[model samples]
Target: MLKKLVLIGGGHSHALVLRLFGNKPLSGVRLALITPDIYTPYSGMLPGHIAGFYSYSQCDIDLQSLSNFAHAQLCLDHVIGLDLKNRKVLCANQPTVDFDILSINISSTPTKLSVPGAVEYTIAAKPVAQFLEHWYQLQENAVRNPQKALNIAIVGGGDVELALSILAGVRKLEIYLFQSSKELMPSHHQSVRRIMRDILSNQDVKLHLGERVCEVVKLINKGLTIKCESGLMVTCDQVFWVTHASAGSWLKAAGIGTDDQGFILVNDNLQSVTHPHIFAAGDIAKMINYQLPKAGVFAVHKGNPLYENLRSMILGESLKPYKPQTAYFSLIVTGDGRVLANRAILPLPSHQLWWCWKDCIDRNFMAQSPHQ
Candidate 1:
């Protein structure tokens, strides 16, 4: 019988895996893809998409056509639970899927903070599809009430800097950004963070540094407010939540070895430490041996090795390990057509030229994707 290979999630890594599988066939193996979304949004261009630089379709990679090329079954359903013993994947809207080898590339969840009234008050800036839908509606409302003062609060660090710029620039709204740390983008170079901090300050963004949000509550008057541990309280028309990035709770609940944040624990080979037959990639996974940031670039890097290892496992061959590079070139696209390129040691100016380069890189990535 042909070995069953089931891929979960249509994330950046899995897109490349499917493309590679489509480019080359593995005999005696049947492939299947289970994802809730038919189109996977490329995180690289997501900022551009939000800034009105790229259309939605331009940034979203079509999985349907790619699956067809790979001769893989595309089950458009959300994987709610996993059955490790039976080697089955439970879906929300479809029948159970059986697999011999399973690879998960599901992107991480936006946040796990269970702040009171968050569900009713705040909008998640992740699970991209939902964010798009909510943002579009909010944008429309903002347009309709152009005279109304639009006050918004974003709960996150420098990761939300791009979104903050867009919200301030595009809508000309009063934006408040709250971070738990004294400095933003602590993982990044000081110059990069300094530049962004300066930009936000000059652009009239209210930066609440070192203030951690404790509780979110809807006011009786008309708006929502969040109280910080530092005793700062602000009422806003909308609260955009981008603070944390955790993994699917199902992985940890199913007894898979995971980090404290619920990201699947895997070796350098991308194979689960506890279950060798299962592999994980993208933001949903944590390399036990290395500290890899949850970046889309890493997900893009893991694709080739993940594909090769999956193929090798079926043939009973030795699996190759993937050691991620410590630092990567990061280009932050400021909403107003400026790009900040971080090369660790280089103190480069944020320029439109960099924006051109970033656009070319992003457009090229989308152009090379599997499409019919």
Candidate 2:
């Protein structure tokens, strides 16, 4: 009997897996990819895209054509839940998909709806499609009214500096960045944080550190109001929620092993702790032994190991355990063609040469897909 392999979400890891499987096929195994979008954006180039450096087609991967190349059934639907006992994958718009083995690569999203009026008034950064739609519309509005003053608020301390710089390019724009913690990027070294802080200050972007947002209100004058737990209020033309990472509640509800934050708990082999037949990768998974940053670089690095282990299991071979690197190089764009290079083990200085290096890396990764 032929076994079925189902891949959920065309994230960076899954995209590489599909490309590899296309080159080497396993006999008596059926493969299928269920994703919400036909073209998935590469997260690495997202900031550049927002900065107007890359076009939509330049940063997006053509998943439809990639799936066709891999000879996998492409089911474009939103997954709602999973039927683990019966080995069925439940979706929002299609019938239950049966699978002998399943791999989940769906990335995470910000904690939306946690604050009042957030869902209605603020924009969540994940589901890149939705955010892009609003961003493109805002750009159009800015173009139409070149002299209008805009107040933009970003409610997160993530690497949104590039996004802030892009907003600052607008004439008569006031940009505010709100962070709950006293410092930004608590994970990085103090020197790195200082560099970012100085850049934002020089750009005239207001910093609201240590302020936890409690509510977002829609004003009657076609604007928005943000209220912080510290009793501070600010009005802005638009609010973008780039808050902490959060996974789907359905994972915990369905009895899958998940961390406190709802990310799937997996072993070193990237197999679910509770379900060995199921694997997870990318931002949606948390390793039991090593805590990995939910970044695109780690996700991309796990691709080869995940592919090898998945192929090993399918061939009745022993699975290989892999450990993620403790230290990695991080290049962050400054939204004006400059980049900041940081190595957790040894922090590097910020320079424009790093931006050229990052562009080459991103373009090479995107060039892997022949259809892209």
Error of 2 at 320 (Å): 0.9
User: Can you write out model 1's per-residue Cα lDDT over 260-313, one digit (the tens) per residue?
Assistant: 999999998999999999999998998989987788899999999999999999
Q: What is the C-alpha lDDT of each candidate?
A: 0.85, 0.87
Off by over 4 Å in 2: 168-171
Q: What TM-score would you give candidate 1 relative to the actual structure?
A: 0.96
Candidate 2 per-residue lDDT over residues 1-372, each given as its tens digit: 788999999999999999988888788889999999999889888888887788889999899988988899999998899999999999998899999999999979889677989988998888778888888888888889988888899988875554554653455778889999999878788888888888788778899999999999998899999999999999999998889889988888888999888999999999999999999999999999998888989889888889888888788799988788887887877778888898874656667789889999999999988593
| TM, every model | 0.96, 0.97
